[model samples]
Target: MELPPGWSALLEDYVAHLDAERGLSPHTVRAYRGDLVELARHCGVGPAEVTLPALRSWLSAMTDAGAASSTVQRRVACVRGFFGWARREGLVAEDPAARLTAPRRRRHLPRVPSRADVDLSLASVSARLSEGDNPLVHRDLALVEVLYSSGLRVSEACSLRLRDVDRERRALTVLGKGGKERTVPLGVPALRALDAWLHRRPEVAGPRSPETVFLGARGGAMDPRVARRVVHAATAGAGRGAETGPHGLRHAMATHLIDGGADLRSVQEMLGHSSVATTQIYTHVTSERLRQAFRQAHPRA
Candidate 1:
């Protein structure tokens, strides 16, 4: 759908701001753009002409069309972000979306693989790579190990450079969301996997290769998609049925850490969450597990 002229130009600038200044990933920028465009089309007016009523109507239309609560919430966020930027940049006199509200999103507990399941997956990947001197196998093993061991986001892991890993400290310097930097410790297994991969990396590194720690078959930086595929394949090979990905490994790491007595603040730092509240979701997981165990063990009715 063609957006109004003023809205179209404003959206382009907002998207650029989000990419260059906000440091959001391209996928996120695209989602924001999509949401804003749909809102602009629904409003049938330019940015300067938008009103709170129009915004409410757009949201109402979305709900009437059966958009999910999450979808509606994201669209509300997109509207708020666009207008907030426009007001600050002088494209709009006032932020019309300032008071706009979205329905509260239901907090769904993240699915975490059991510790035994994670171990089984890693063992399966190790066995598969044991028979071969293939660089790809080594890279996959290292990718999964680092993902589970340090709770690194898949994008952060894919974007890692050779200098980011400190062998002496057994830690990685990760550039996480909003351009924040943090150091997370690596486990012994992760260190060994990384060492194996690094030794074989020279075979795959070419003249055009970047300084990225992990390389693809074409001798360039590994993409997040490749990392996700590695996780899915590894999990499936381990005989697990539920859908698993790199983020699932991250959740499992955090859950397991809490279960094993890691403190909340430390887990927050390790996971790169901006707030400890964001890291508290794992506590819910542990509490639920405790409740389940109680139900199973208690004999009295």
Candidate 2:
């Protein structure tokens, strides 16, 4: 759908602001742009002409069309942020989205793999590693170990440069969301796997390859999608059959940390979450798992 010229120009400016001033990721900026475009398409007017009725009608139409509550909530947030920016920037005299409301997005507990499941997955990768000193196998082993051990996001893991690793400290300097950098500890297993892969990195390293810690088969920078596939294949090979991906491994790491008595603030820092509230979900995950265990083990009814 074609956006109003005014909306297009304003959105472009706002996107630039999000990228430069706010340091939002490209993915987030793209989402904001898409949401605003949809809103502008629904309104079919310049930014100055958008009114509360038009905004409400657009949201009503989305609801009528059966958009998910989360989608609606995100669009609402997008509009609120955009219009708030417009008002502050004098692009519009008033913000019509101020009165907009959306359904609360339901938070489902994420399926966190058990420690045994993660162990089985890593063991599957390790067993493959035993066949030969295959560089790709070493890379896969290191990737899963790092993901499960440090709870690094797949993107963060992929973004790792050789300089980001500190062998003596046993840590990785991960650049996370919004370009925030955090140091995450590497477990002994992950460190060993990483060492093995680094030793053989040259075999796959292409001439054009950067100093990226992980590389694709051709030795270019590792793609997050490919990394996700590696994680899935490892888990599926262990009999879990795609039950978890990189993020699931991250969740498992956090849950295990909490279950092992790690503090919430420390876990939040390690996961590079900007808010502690986001990390609190793992506590909920732990509680839910405990309830499940009680239901299975307790005989009293």
Candidate 3:
């Protein structure tokens, strides 16, 4: 198979490992590849020429190029990954990018939509498919249902296998960060949507015996990018504005649950978050809502 432009042969090897050995979702593997390709283009050299100072210089160039801190950090990680792969394959005696560090990004609160906003978004998605213009309607609707209902990432939403979804229990096993798998409940909306999608999934999936729950127009795996586009269009079509993305829906899911008096830990498990600390961030949002309510209702004004 051909590698990404400017990708080192070692990167190609590591990417294979990430897929076959690590069970990393294709989306993540692509991200790592994209970052590495950018690094390779900057270094102007092949795998054997990578060095610590050169890596640092690339980081400096990224900073100068006005890359976001988060993006820059990802680039650094990709460079480090290349070195790690090189050492593992015995191409290098020691990893030169070992001591390199990704830049720190200022933490900002995640964006979560209100109930009205989520309703509009979901309704819009549903409305589009009901029109019959797109045969992938069931697939799109099912994806939206699972995403909003279970709070899955876009990658997880699309990668779901048919067997992973348990019809009797209305639950599915989600493979999340670090290849961790967790069983999450699906609501009636998700179940119904999934049922409808299964009815029409074969139409879009041409001729493959794909066990995947969702498929693209070509009968293969749906790209997360396409999932994102569908979501953006649906949300915009419903007049919810175009500010939010799929993960924003995840933020909305966690926040809505908290707003409905659900425990933070329970929210963490639902989102498949590894850290309670990560889930704790939503508490801040709820607290803000409380303050807003208090200020609005109190006579102190």
Q: Write the per-residue lDDT of candidate 2 for residues 1-301, one digit (tens) a residue.
A: 6777687789889999999988988888999898888888888899999998998898889989999988888888899989999999888999998998888777768877778888988998999977986889999999999999899999999989999999999999999999898999999999999999999999999789999999999989999999999998887743243248898899889999999999999999999999999899999988987898899999981
RMSD of each: 1.8, 1.8, 4.3
**What is the model-wide C-alpha lDDT for candidate 1?**
0.90
What does the lDDT read for residue 139 in candidate 1? 87
Name the better of 2 and 3 by TM-score: 2
Q: TM-score of predicted model 1?
A: 0.94
Error of 2 at 187 (Å): 0.4
Q: Find the 10 residues in a row with the least total lDDT in model 1.
A: 235-244
Q: Which is better, 1 or 3, measured by lDDT? A: 1
Model 2: residues with Cα > 4 Å off, grouped in runs: 237-243
Writing each residue's lDDT as its tens digit, candidate 3 over 48-90 gives 6668888899889879988899888777777777688778878
Structural similarity to truth (TM-score) of each candidate: 0.94, 0.94, 0.77
2 against 3, candidate with superior lDDT = 2
Cα displacement (Å) at residue 72, model 2: 2.0
Candidate 1 — which pairs collide?
Answer: none
Tens digits of lDDT, candidate 1, 34-81: 888888888888889999999999989989999999999988888898
Q: What is the lDDT of residue 118 in candidate 3?
A: 73
Ranking by TM-score: 2, 1, 3
